[model samples]
Target: MSLFDTYIAVDWSGGNDRGAKPKRDAIWACAAGEEPVYLRNRQVAEDWLAARLEAEAGRRVCVGFDFPFGYPAGFAEHLTGREDALALWDWFEARIVDAPDVNNRFDIAGEINARVSGVGPFWFNGLKREVNHLPRKGLDRTNADFPEKRLVEMRAKGSFTCWQMAGAGSVGSQVMMGLPVLARLRRKYGAKVWPFEALDSAVAFVEIWPSLLAPSFPGGMIKDAAQVRAVARAMAVMDGQGSLELALAKGEGSGAEGWILGVGAEDLLEAAMKPIDMPRPPKLRDDCFALPAGVDWTPVDEALARLDAALRCVVGVEQVSHTQVVGRVVAEPVTARRSNPPAPNSAVDGYGFAHDATGEGDQVLPLLAGRAAAGGAYGGTVPHGSAIRVLTGAVLPDGVDTVVLEEDCSVTDTHVAFRGPVRPRANTRKAGEDVVAGSDVFAKGHMLRAQDAGLLAALGVDALPVFKRLRVGVLSTGDELVDPSQNAPPDRTYDANRPMLLQLAAAWNFEAVDLGHVRDDRAALKARLDEAVGQCDVILTSGGASAGDEDHVSALLREQGNLQAWRIALKPGRPLALALWQGVPVFGLPGNPVAAFVCALIFARPACLKLAGAAFAEPQGFMVPAAFEKRKKPGRREYLRARMGSDGVEVFASEGSGRISGLSWSDGMVELPDGAMDIARGDLVRYLPYGSFGL
Candidate 1:
């Protein structure tokens, strides 16, 4: 059976403020099993939908609005350095203003176009001739950065680009004005946006192109309530046929480039909804966590400092051969086994002679009788009138204080002549110059690299003392989670957090132990903890830390061990729970994949390093201009997944923590600190690259 119990279709507008009556320019809404209604303004439309959604919180509902859910992927990246569709709404919300008689949709569109390229791609400005930025041309040269069509635009035949703001078949104005209303709806009710955030048990907002359904409605009912009613009925039919999901299935570039639900499902809608042979995944749970009352929230810096202070390195070191010690932390300082070279040598292919052998007027000297090579040196001192032939790296002959380059001298079998002045020891390497005897080559806590190992080998050190690798136990705790290898029942999901964490641990050079999954029951969690406490230096678990009925991880920790903190003043990763179980450190991460990944890198990486007898690693961030704007409250820090672009770093278009795709799409994160608000375009912000975290 389809999860959704109701379907709603809305015909959005892009013109000036909504009309007082049901007109072509006003917002129109119709729901399956209900009469079509005309809303006078955006606010009323929002209120009407909000009321219905509030009453049906327990039932699944899907609302489809006739507007572009997101811009073309390139425009989003160029303007905001983000591919998240919801972020583009934030960009519009800060700039566009909607009023009954007038709206700034055209102005906003022009502003965005100006930022995209010197010449705007959005053309055909409205009746107002004063909006000089938009050209009147039907087609014009476009910026390569901003493509004319979104992925859906190319896929759906006869579809119009969301860029057209004026003229016939233009939905651009509706997009600018409509997005803010949708943003409010999503924010007030925490509605999931399809293809970005996962479908919700309560409600989801999807993008629909009404024209795709218009042909199904008979003639004479082209552009009014009748058309909306017909479209709503079509939705009901599609839903009943079990083809709604096929339409809702993510299309190519659906997240950043919006897709029209049911755009290409002609024959599929004719079939009846049937159960698939494969096992179904679990229904999504709304178990978001926040800081508990009466508990003081810890700042990120302070929390890290406290964690490092409390963690002690795991004891025990192993002696490893120098060649095998690469990437291992040194347990003790390594001193030079012997002085480098053990004797003075030539720095270049040159001649060796006494510094004062040449007279003031006679710069040329007779070729020396003795010759010095790398392994064999001249035994006796050279005569004052002669010079010795010494190749590069050859030991200096006895009584030779200087060496001259072969290129600077004209040489024959009998004599050598100088073209320039030669300084004493100019091309000579003194004994112990590279490394003196007993000098420390590498200090304790230094992670040995290939070059360091090679240098140690050169010094004849065969074995080295290095700290033993720390063992990390990874666990996934949730009744709704199942192993991917197993056939999961409905209401269960394949575990993703455990495998991801295990892979990350391996990359960080830790001995990762898969502690496996635990049920939500307190006893099951306790048993898993007991099994892991003695086997690993650190334990990491995903889920079961929230204040939900099924959550047991936090409760078990509070009763059996120290439950230090429940949440940090951070976004996405706020629900982190830290504890100590039988003296083994435990990190309880949020169940959301993105949240789990971010928390692991931010909080877990440093803690693991400290436990492995390595120096605390502080990830450095670079400052870059924000391609998009954001308005947020002060106090808590927020991290938006982003990727580096040719211009600057762009954030992921969506902020849904449930969207695991964001982790792979993003190269790093953009940090908004406490008290940060209103990030205008081109504002400097701190960017943390994933590579900086040693990933």
Candidate 2:
């Protein structure tokens, strides 16, 4: 039996209307076991597809559309700070406007081209649309951010540039209108869009270059319906022979950049073609870590840069009351609702006078007719050379520009004699000095503290828009592990990594969820992950990450999601596993408690902060003298648990990662550089305190 109940091939149109019969300006759809359908517009096609998909409920349905699912990978990263092809679909869906005969595909293409450095990437505007930015000629203009063609487009001989919207053979218009339909289908049917997301899903929607398959049919058949029918029939035959599955397996591209469904079956196609050289690795890998052989292990700095580029902030914002916003990160810029002090007020309990008192000789001024106290002010302007009795924080009377402290002046009931010289506006608080009206008090991504809350409250702000706390699920997996409260056999020990990680998460202002422990059974680990993925923004687990015979976490992830990267060049923590399970990020640390602690501090903590929409955090470290001699390898960087003493920083007696007591015994850690070296006593070493990592 075929893997899917039906196979569909669609030839899309860029034109604005349902052209006359036999014209190529209408959508043509052909399904296995059914005749080809010529749809007049996008809405009609979408309604038709939705009904077909609903009729095939509980069965796998495979659909292929003729258009670029995503643009060139570099353009994607430059626009979205990510290279995932699926993200491009969302980007287009948000920007492109598709109406039956009045779409703005050409205009949007011109707008996107303007963002890049050069012109002509998106040339060839439609006849009616006058896009000033889009140039007609000079299509050879170079932009460093975008490639000339996507990988699949270059691989297929007859493919056109998705950037060209108006010219003949241009796929740009089709892409702009097609992606929104694909996004809607994905939302309604949960269809797996290939090369942008993965192909492990049941109901799959893939990108197809109809020209790649159009050559197999008889020549001189110019009808669009005949082309789609021939391609659909050919795909059904391929499905019967199990060639379709092989094609899907071979078409996997860097995530969400699309690959043609039949690129892998170039040999089977009638056209005599040489293999097109796919672009060199774009300095990024979406499916897995590029642990190429003969390459040295990644340095700590390079690893951190890669991690930052690969991750994105979790979505969604929350309205938090000012009183309860402490420890929350701001999701939007916070503006001051009102100026501090609101009006001109006295900076001290003193006498206010209208004079440049700091002149050569002290000017004796008469007392003002009224007194201005806090919560009660003197309304009228002060007479010339007259002083007003003003208390601290009271609004200063008009015409009085300076204040002289009561002690600085010899005072009497009728008048006051100023002895010390004073400058204009001295000791007078100006309106809006502390906080100007409509000024941004706090920017987005600022983590709220006690003082921040107090400042917001003073501005009369009762609520703030803050990112919701990242809920981290912590777990420990091992067959020989038991709960801390339960007794264990001599061969087994209590679970410590979970509690430590949970506490660390809480300390770092995350919502920590203890997922309990699971044995090394594959089924058991899978069950725990299924439970945690929905509740947590990210999952952290200790043990079972290594490629041991009984290790199940890595194995389960391989089956359910994807294992992106594993292992880092850092001592005390090396067997680190990074994966995605049901779209939730998972960070797997070593089983050893000490290693788990170090990894949590170095990796998981920063990852959590990013997910919570906070900025990158690098714990500050200082250089201190090495108090004890130590030897280390050359390649991987190492951290030694140590305490500061009279001489300098002292290393822990033992180097084992399982030595949990060493963490508490030492005040912080001493970092050693990569390369084989000997640390002599009194040698300078970089030191980081536990507090620096937000202990």
| Candidate-wise lDDT, in order | 0.76, 0.76
Off by over 4 Å in 1: 1-295, 359-362, 375-381, 486-490
Worst 10 residues of 1 by lDDT: 280-289
Model 2 lDDT tens row, 620-654? 89998888997787888888899999989898999
Cα TM-score of candidate 1:
0.55
Q: What is the C-alpha local distance difference test score of candidate 2? A: 0.76
Candidate 2 regions with alpha-carbon error over 4 angstroms = 1-296, 357-359
The worst-scoring run of ten residues by lDDT in candidate 2 lies at 272-281
How far residue 646's Cα lies from its native spot in candidate 2, in Å, is 3.7
Task: Give TM per candidate.
Answer: 0.55, 0.57
